[model samples]
Target: MPEPVVVDAMGGDHGPAETVGGAVLARREHGVPVVLVGRAGEIRAELARHGAVDEIDVVHAEEAVPMGERGTGGAASGASSLRVGCELLRQGAGSALVSAGSTGAVVSCAIRGVGRAPAVLRPALAIALPAVTGGATVLIDAGATSDPTPEMVAQFALLGASYARLVLGAADPSVGLLSIGAEPGKGNRLTRRVAELLPLLPLRFHGNVEGHDVLAGAVDVIVTDGFTGNVVLKNVEGAVRAVLTLVARSGTAAPEALREVARRYGPETHGGAVLLGLSGTVVVAHGSSRAATVARACAVAHDLAGGGVAARLRDHLTAEPVN
Candidate 1:
């Protein structure tokens, strides 16, 4: 049997009920074993309510990291659910860790607990966005390393390409530097420098791509610094929400075509971002995740772990000489 996914059951905005419910849903829908890490009593109560008390395991954690706490450097806090989840992964009790907690805390804890892959300067968060043409475009450095070095950005490209291949099944993923323009020298110094290093890697370099090209599927992977990638992700999410709201207000009830588009492209449906370059699979779900989103996240975590994402990343990175 595959190892279970460890979940920070108290990490989301909706509280333990939703988180636990999601875990149950994931087990039912995808047959993914999950170990809920949080206050045992609370988690048990929640599980009992769903009549799933015997279906999942519970590990006690006394506290949860707040959304504002940053720079913890992955220090293990016995009270923190996120820390406990990472610890479970480190101890080989679970194959992956899933948390809808503070992104910073999850990233920090995963790094400190599971450690980084060989030759990885910093880990990145990779999110797959549904593209207009078909398939998905992966955007890396979603918010992990805000001010990464040029070499770091180059590493992100390779990481993103590997992700596109493993998760999205892109035979030969095309990598593009996210910049102001499609020209080689369009972006700032960091992008320009990274652009020069991309072609030398064992990837299908597509040169520089603009922001619009992200959703247009111009490239399989779009690499950018964490700050810019985060901003772009939020903007795209907001745009999608705004359009859906406008359609609702117009009393059009959203045509089937538009509904299908929204369903495919929505962030909730994609589960959450995967933290690449870590020793184990770590999925950081949105803080506002509810039962459905949480379940989706668990499914993603299971797939990533079972698919050998970390090993593949390590092998690929180790084979390439760091610039």
Candidate 2:
């Protein structure tokens, strides 16, 4: 039997009600079992409201982490829902963890509680975006480590490639370094140094890729430092939302083609980003996630856990030294 996914039921914008409702939906629609970790009384109340009290289990967590507390020293303390959820994963109570909590808290607790995979210097947050040609393109280091070494960028390429194969089902995933220009020496010192290191790794190196190539799916995976990646991701998301809003306000009803395009570009439909390089599968959902987004996040966690993503990553990383 597959292990259950541990959900931080009290950690999203909507709290327990929406989180529990999403867990129920995941079980009903995707057949994925989840154990909700939060104040037992509140979680049970929400489950009872949906008449799904018997469908899932609830674990007690005394506190909840506030969104503002992230990135601070206290983010992972306080017996918070995310902290307890990570503890459960460490103890084998669950195979993976899905949280819409503070990304810093989740990342911190995961590293401290579950530890990092062997040979992995840092974990990366990977977001999959819709590709123009057909499949999806993965952007790594979305917001995990803001300042990364050139070697870390090289590791991100490997981690992203493994993800593309296991999750995106790409055969021989091609990797591209996000830079100012497509030329080998166009980026800053980091990109130039990483460019020289990428070909030496066990991946299909496609040289440098400009910003436009991201949506064009010029490569299966685009690797960059966390700061730049986060800025690019937010910009793309904001642009997509603005365009969709304009289409809605236009006199004509949104056509099916336009709606499909919106759906394809939206982040809510894709659940959220996954934190790679950890010993366990950890999914970080959007902070403003509602029930549908939570359900998709749960499904993503279950699928990645069942696919043994952590194990694959460990093997791939250990196979060759990063230095």
Per-residue CA lDDT of model 2 for 80-110, tens digit only, reads 7888888887777888899888676777778
Quantify all predictions' global Cα lDDT against the true fold.
0.81, 0.82
Model 1 TM-score on a 0 to 1 scale: 0.78
lDDT of 1 by residue, 118-198 (tens): 567677889989888877899998888899998788888887887888778899999989999888978899999998888
Best candidate per TM-score, number? 2
Q: Report how far residue 79 has shifted in candidate 2, in Å.
A: 1.6
Reference-based lDDT, residue 184, model 2: 97
For model 1, the stretches where C-alpha displacement exceeds 4 angstroms are 49-55, 65-78, 102-105, 108-114, 237-270, 288-292, 318-323
